[model samples]
Target chain A: MHDIGVRETIRFLGLTFNIETLKMTWLAMGIVILIACLATRNLKVVPQGWQNFVEMIILWLHDQIDAMMGRRGRMLAPFIVGLFMFLLASNLIGLVPLMASPTNDLNTTLGLALLVVVMVHCLGLYFKGGHYIAHFFQPTPVFVVINMIEEIAKPITLAFRLFGNILAGEILIIVLLKLMPIWMPIPSVCWLAFSIFISCVQAVIFTMLSMAYLANAVKEDHAE
Target chain B: MIVLIEINATILAQILNFLILVVLLRAVAYKPVARLLQQRSDKIKGDLDKAEADRKAAEQTLEQYKVQLADAHKKAQDIVDKANVTARQEHDAAVAETRKEIERMKATAQAEIENERNRAFDEMKSQIVSLSLAAAGKVVMKNIDTKENDKLVNDFISKLDKNMFADLR
Candidate 1:
């Protein structure tokens, strides 16, 4: 359980890097890129096989984004879609023998959450300008402190939600394997299947929340 | 104790990796597929429009041909009717001319017959007068009475009827 919190570090050019999470992240990214390339290499007006599958997934994601953010949400589709894909891949890779899930790491999840938060704020500022900062002072001046704290807690909540779910699933599977080593295959398989479902749900939730945040930030205040 | 909460280079590295993945995937996959879909939709719309235009043009051409054919049929009928009327008029005129010529020949023949009959009647009358005169002379010469013979001749000539000689002339 302590190993879940500790990352194996590698020193290169006097900079400390988390070797395990970086390796797994790169591996997941490479898999996604390779599949994407193969699917798009011989693209036709009519799709087939993997291309058909990938296009369906992309269309589904686009619809989800559209539902969340209206027509303007299309601009954020590739980023949101990429985030979902990467997280889903990272989460599912943990089911493989001896492979650690990158999302199980607090640093990785926090980094992704911070990225989404930064993008939301930047987009809000770009779209709403000074009116974006004025939203925090709404209803009364006394509620401004509460609104600021709530805003600050958003990214922390987003990060921990994914990290806790994935890390807990991984730790439970490990404890199950340790306790029942002889008859562990059946329970481990069931747990793995359940974990896979959880991974998918967590990925979807993360993407949905990110889209919702972006929509809220960039949306024009209709109250006026 | 606070080491777990510390922000480090690993977080920065993950951010970089995520950004790189997003950029790469967007470039390689999403944009091209979306563009292809849009292009296919446009092409389909264009093809449909062209098909509709072609259909309308064909319909217009068919209508024009029908109108021209109807006009030609009417003109041909008119020409046939006019020829029929002209032929009928010419036939009637020829028949009228033939009837007039036959009437004129009949009138001329009647007049010639009348003239011949009149000449024949005059010759017969002269012959009768000569015969009567000869007989009178013989009688007169035999009996020796000239006044009585002349009176007898005058009475015979006056007693002849003009209507009785009409059939003979």
Candidate 2:
């Protein structure tokens, strides 16, 4: 129980690696890859079994991206779908005994958020050129600072929202298991069930926010 | 909170992980799946078009057969009519030939009857001339000249039998 709060930190080439988070991240990646392989193997024109299941999830994600940015977001589908699978697996993995969620680590969540934000700006620059950067100065120079703050807050909120929820839920579970003796299994079980629900909700919220941010970058009309 | 948000190499590693995953997954899954779906849709479109063409060809062939059937019926009817006309002509020609033969037979029989009656009348005249001559010679032996009596009897026979033979004719 004491070891639950501690991460296995490793030093390699003068850089500290959070090995525990890395291990869980790799496990999540393996799950994602396994699912991808299963879905794509022996693929029939008429889908069945795992192919049917994976197609349903993928088609839903595609519809979301398509609805958000229509045809322009077509290229972004792979990255978006991959991100969702990773997030979903990372967030839910903590529920298994002796395992922890990779998303509970701030580094992992921040890394994902930064990746999305950077890609959004890159896509904006690629599609719209100078207007992408010029949007921050719209409605007069007075609004530049506000727009800049809004831009900075986007990734911060995106990262912290997911990290905080997952970490807090895991921390509570740990707390309930270790200290709470008044009402033992009831609260712990309830919180665990609730945390599972929270994990799913948080993953979906992250994915949706990322899509929305990306859509804004490639939008038809610049509303800034 | 300060310790938790520390910038470290882990963030870089995680980004690398994501990038590698994307590349691998794209190769294994996305491109192939999209292509397969496109292939199936294209195949369906081609099949449907071929089916429509086949249906149209079958219909055209059926229409041609129907037309051919109708023509055959018309041709058969024409053959029957021509045969009937030829049969009627043959029947009429045969009847005309039979009537001509009958007329010729009747004409020949009547000519033969006329020739036989003339021959019988010639024989009777000869017999009657001989008998009258003999009878007159016996009756008037020394009373008249022989040469004069013969002339008188011949004149009498000619006068008496003249209309009788005419009536018989």
Q: What is the TM-score of each candidate against the true structure?
A: 0.72, 0.75
User: Once superposed on the true structure, which residue ranges of model 2 sit more than 4 Å away at CA?
Assistant: A1-4, A176-193, A219-224, B1-7, B59-70, B87-169
Candidate 2 local lDDT, A1-224, one digit each (tens): 32645666888999998887899999999998988998898888888888777777777887898899878987888888888888889989987867888898888999999999999999999988998888878878889999989889999999999999998988888888888887668989999999989998998999999999999887677453
Candidate 2 lDDT tens digits, B51-128: 999999999999999999999999999999999999999999999999999999999999999998998888878878
lDDT of 2 at A137: 81
Residue B157 C-alpha lDDT in model 1: 60
Off by over 4 Å in 1: A1-6, A181-184, A220-223, B1-7, B72-169
Error of 1 at A33 (Å): 0.9
The global Cα lDDT (0 to 1) of model 1 is 0.85
Instruction: Give the DockQ-based CAPRI class for model 1.
Output: acceptable
Cα lDDT for residue A90, candidate 1: 94
On TM-score, the candidate that comes out on top is: 2
